[model samples]
Target: MLTALKEETYKFCHEKIALLGLLVLLVTTLYSTLTKTINKSTLIFAFGAIEWIPVIIIAVGAAFFEMEYDNKTIVMLLYKNSSKLKIYLAKFLVVFCYSIALALGAILLTFLLSLLTVPGQYHWLAYYQGHTILTNLLLNLFGAVIYCFFIVGLSFMLIMLVKANTVVICIGLVLAYFGASFSTALMHTFPTAVGILKWNPLNMIFISQQLTRGSFALKSNLTNFQLIIATVVYGIIFGLLGYYLFKRRRV
Candidate 1:
């Protein structure tokens, strides 16, 4: 397992396209941050741009698996004693770790840049009163990480099933962004199915937004606890399904 993980990580790290994606994330984040006010709220908003990070990582994950199949490398790995489960999980873990690291790096960079560029505008105290800045920021970051896992894991599951990088990435992004909005609107229209609709994985994508800002919940009936639980359940389901499918794949 350890050897498989190291091999997966090394492949991801060495990919020029993957490195370019990270560079794009950093550049775009910096540009977006500088355009807005440099404060606690703005810092969070800047990192919110990281919603696209998972999409790039999803492509990476799909490519990681597809390349092996294309080159018939899976045969070599099996002969060298690597189990299907180990390779599958190693790819998943690498993609998952990249998603989390990209999020953290973007958030931290935004905070530091905000401090350096506009120290006078740093309003951590006013933005989140009664709670220390660190506490509020940490809680918010935790929620963001949870959402990241949902998207990354869901993408992993889809890629495994579809085995097409572009199709999976496109479908995943649409679901991640528009799925919740449309579902919430429909739930409002029907009003009776809110209970079941709220549990949809796509609808739970905005869990972090609802967590950090009370105003974000004005349109929805879901509580933070419900969203958190739904996110966890969906993440686990996606992960398990991916593992099952990979284990059963012919190649």
Candidate 2:
């Protein structure tokens, strides 16, 4: 496992697409933060810079999985690792870590931009939405961590099953942006199955919203804790299923 993880990390670091994706994420973060006219620094701090996180995650995740198949490297990886599960997990872990790194980068850049662009505008201790700016930021980041796991797992599973990077990326982007909205619409349209539909993976995307503002629970019909649990559960399910498919796939 350790060997597989090291190789995976090294490969990811050397990938041009990974570096380009990081650059794009940083640029978009800056653009999103600077373009917002709202003076609410806390809101800008938590959300503005992270607006492109899901898109980047989807793109990078698709590329990571597809690259192995495209380059015919999976045969070598399978021969070297002996354990398909280890290889799959190592790749997933590398992508998951990349997602966390993106989040941290966004947070750091948002803070620095806030300082340089609007000096004294942000108050870490100042309350916003019933919590301090710093508190809200942390909560949002925590939610983002869970979201990353869910999305990355979903991405890996989709790529393994579809074997098409473009299609996987498109599906992922749509879900990242509209999954919550679609889930809401479903619940409304089929009001009788709200209980089961509320637990759907799509609805779990609202964990961040509910965590940042308790009022969002009314819309999600779930508490922050419930959302967190559901998201984690779905993430694990996808990861296991992806591994199963990867193990059974023809080399």
Q: Pick the candidate with the highest lDDT.
A: 2
Writing each residue's lDDT as its tens digit, candidate 2 over 35-108 gives 76635544534545444676678778878988998999988988877888888888889998998888788778
Candidate 2 deviant stretches above 4 angstroms: 41-47
Residue-level error in angstroms, candidate 2, position 214: 0.8
lDDT of each: 0.71, 0.80
lDDT of 1 by residue, 1-251 (tens): 99989988998788775687678678777776657655566565554554656556666666777777777987787777557778777877887788777767766776677777877665655546345555556556667667766766676688678888789878867875787688778778888887776666667766766776666566556788887887878877888888887777777
Error of 2 at 193 (Å): 1.7
Q: Which candidate is the best by TM-score?
A: 2
Off by over 4 Å in 1: 34-40, 129-136, 218-220
TM-score of model number 1: 0.85
